[model samples]
Target: MTDLPFDPIQLMREHPEKMHIPGGLLTKQGPQDYVGGVPAITGTLFFNDAHTAEVREAICACFDEYEVIAKAHLTWLWRAEPPEGPDKFVYEKAPSMRAMIKRMNENDLVSFTYVSGKQPHDAGDWEFQVFGRRGWEAKMIVRGTSALRFTMPLLHVEKNPAAFQAMFVSFAKRLKALHGYGGQGLVLSAPRESDNQPFEAYLANMLNGLDVGEPVGATRSAHLGIKTVSWLTAVNHKMIEKIGGLSAIRSELPMDWFALYDYGAGLVVQAGPKPEGAPADQPKPARLVLPNMLFKEVRAPKVSLHYASKEGEPRLIGWGAEQWLQRFDVPEDEVQAYKARLLDEPKLTKATTLPDRL
Candidate 1:
């Protein structure tokens, strides 16, 4: 594919919403305008079928012509430690897309939604569209108008290494073609089973951070997304409003994220002992996810993190704020010093002792 001239300055001036900020507000303020509204495309193809190669080719060819940009997305890998084999996954069986098509004629293996940078955003709610390779095996999934609508946290695809590799390699080859052309429309996403070692490795090299931003359909989602602002943690609008009133908050944080928390409890030292006591009361790291003011104010409370397994391989995903409390674990005998206040304290006590008092 012929390389196209893509000028940041010109594009930004023409369409400020899509350009980086340098000479204008976009440079400083960031991309406020969103423009990615091509109804996402999706289709299910059998693992080994006559049409498989054509589909791969078409997707690849189209990718070569796409406008490239960086976008963040959810990615996973499931390759086992190889003993002494070629270390290749699924592509070998149907090396050539042509072979894949032929294999399809005999028996097909269906693939779930092999999403693109563009597709995941289209299937908001972070849903995945399923597409199986063949029709005979139960693995052959039926195509739907929208996404597969599976529950959250995604399905881990560890056991099915064989099928996972086949789907991933073909999908990745297509991605590499796009990368070669600077394609940036899709956010890399996959069901756990479909992403194996080789597939994950290739993606790690191609993508730097799991957190990124790009035009998703009509809107733009910063590649690394803001987890929905958690009620227990900060990231709540009302909390900010109460803190210093709405005027003090920045126009926006790079992104917003929320964590799901449940009521739970852990050991807390009732009080420290004095000289007469043996060092004081006992305390431990409490497994509590409470709406305490202290936790919310901590800077860089990130919901998404960077990940890289080995030294040379590209970083995949990393740990975000990871403190989930189970509801069943609440202690029967613990007590709160005081319940959280939404509209400041009742003002029963004197003023100077309070921290955000006017």
Candidate 2:
């Protein structure tokens, strides 16, 4: 648990033929040069417009708590056009970071990617990303409000789930988040590009619990709604009411295993002691039954995943993407029967198949 199940960056390096162009150019130097490789635990918080100041402070606090900069070799900033960009903007020093965030205007994008390693330019052991769109409603074609997203290495969460939960709650309260989900997921080497998604879809199919879609895209489509259930699912006061009161939810999700933590603005529902990912070869994920029930109650829609792929690699797009999203959905009439079957299934064990060998 101290390490990722597999090194994603290494996968790209070992299978360069499998990688797409442009975005995959960053990996041309091999896995050890770039920062990202580990599987990630991501949290995406959505809220109303104009709270960039608070979000900036929260990010700083989080970085300070984790000593993110001390371990990071590369820090990237994304900008739209001239004055803001001619090439990728790379900055050093905390003062500049704070200034960059402070000057952000309405509808302006705030993006940062930190590549962390024990030594400068060393193979990245962990990767962290921050993305938010201030007053996005006026700018985005999809009409999204505003969102703050964080991606942390899975090793960190595996080390301390409690601490991770606390950090998430802290963010939800400060951002006054409307809704969000956090758990196992893949972090792209070049997140802004579509290159890594084909690989993501392949992995997601094998590891059904992993969320493979881009967080910013989810923010646009799932405004004030649930995206998908995960280890930690947060819903605001308004959403809690729509899904039946807190008590009603609590009654359905047994208190013995499911822990509900209040974050002032909303509450986070923790499915179990830790995040769970059921590999395709393993027994059906009985663990997800309760979470899926919540997903149904919240009326979460089938999420979309990127479709672009290499010549003959595994692809999840169009109708394929639709099937992946509905994998956990149980029909209304079959809910009881489905729950019974899932609940009675055996748990994953030492013999359970793992995706590491793939």
Candidate 3:
């Protein structure tokens, strides 16, 4: 397996500076091997408020906690010169993690990307991004909100999901996240502009459970509501109130099937014991219906196009991307049918019993 092109961890460990990015890895492997074998799990949270002193501190602390478990997965950051200068996107090395965070605290709008490799843009095994649109309040129309996101190896998550969940809850508690979701997500080489998008766009269409995510667009477009539901979904107090509070949600979604955790200012709903990327081509929507109900309640404001098309290559953009985001949407006529099915399913009472497939 170490010899395989998809094994980024092995390559990174062998020659830290000479690692291949996701696009390069894809070039060396077939589409099935590339998308199916990429071992990354992503988590993102959106904040309505600015990256204030308290919020910045909490963000750094969460990163520290994650570092303890990922074991030095972050090594370098892409920082612009003159830390307090006007908006500029440059990948300069930071003097230290503490210093980099201090600079982040000073700025109103910041874009920070931390990679695991020694070099700035090396195809590291893990990555963290903090895009703050803190100064948008003064603008005529607020475009994007602040967002904090990270991607790491799935093996770490499998080994200790509790630790990761604890960290995720801490983020929601301290940051006062408006809404967020995390689970099986792709970590592209160039997240903003990557050659892997065509394949990602393909897998996104095929997998109902995979999170086809982009923090920047999500922060911008999801101002009205959540983007999508995943293994873990976090919604703040305000959002919960919109859908009739915790009591109403509990009544609609049975506790026996879904586990809900209170994180001070919000709640994190766990869909199942483990993350699943159920095939989108399947006829049955058994595993998707439960979450689909919650998704419909939240109703994502808009679904931004995740991939840009080349002159002639296969891709999902425009109408195609919008259709994929609404893949779980039940037609108005079929809504009652789905609701009836959900009501008839028995809740799992035994520890070993499978969760309700609503």
Over the stretch 1-358, how does candidate 3's per-residue lDDT look in tens digits? 1124343434423442343344422223433322222436677888865556666767777667666655456665564333564322333434444455576544355566676654444435577777766544414225756788877676666665554566677777777887888777666644333455554565566577677746776676767778777767888777788778888768656666566777777888765555656566554243356566655667665766454554444455677766766777766677557655644444334341223222
Better of 1 and 2 by TM-score: 2
**lDDT (tens digit, per residue) of candidate 2 on 127-184:** 4455566555534535664555566655556555465676677777776777887777
Worst 10 residues of 2 by lDDT: 349-358
Tens digits of per-residue lDDT for model 1 on 214-297? 111101111112222111121223334444533333211100111121111110101101000011122211212122222233
Q: What lDDT would candidate 2 get against the real structure? A: 0.57
Roughly what TM-score does model 1 have, to 2 decimal places?
0.20
Rank order by lDDT, top first? 3, 2, 1
Give Cα-based local distance difference scores for all models. 0.22, 0.57, 0.60
TM-score of candidate 3 to 2 decimals: 0.76
lDDT of 1 at 178: 10
Q: After superposition, how far is residue 65 of candidate 1 from its true place, in Å?
A: 29
Per lDDT, the best of the predicted structures is: 3
Q: After superposition, how far is residue 250 of candidate 3 from its true place, in Å?
A: 1.8
The lowest-lDDT stretch of 10 consecutive residues in candidate 3 is 28-37
Candidate 2 — which residues are off by over 4 angstroms?
1-37, 50-95, 117-125, 134-142, 300-304, 307-315, 333-358
Global lDDT for candidate 1? 0.22
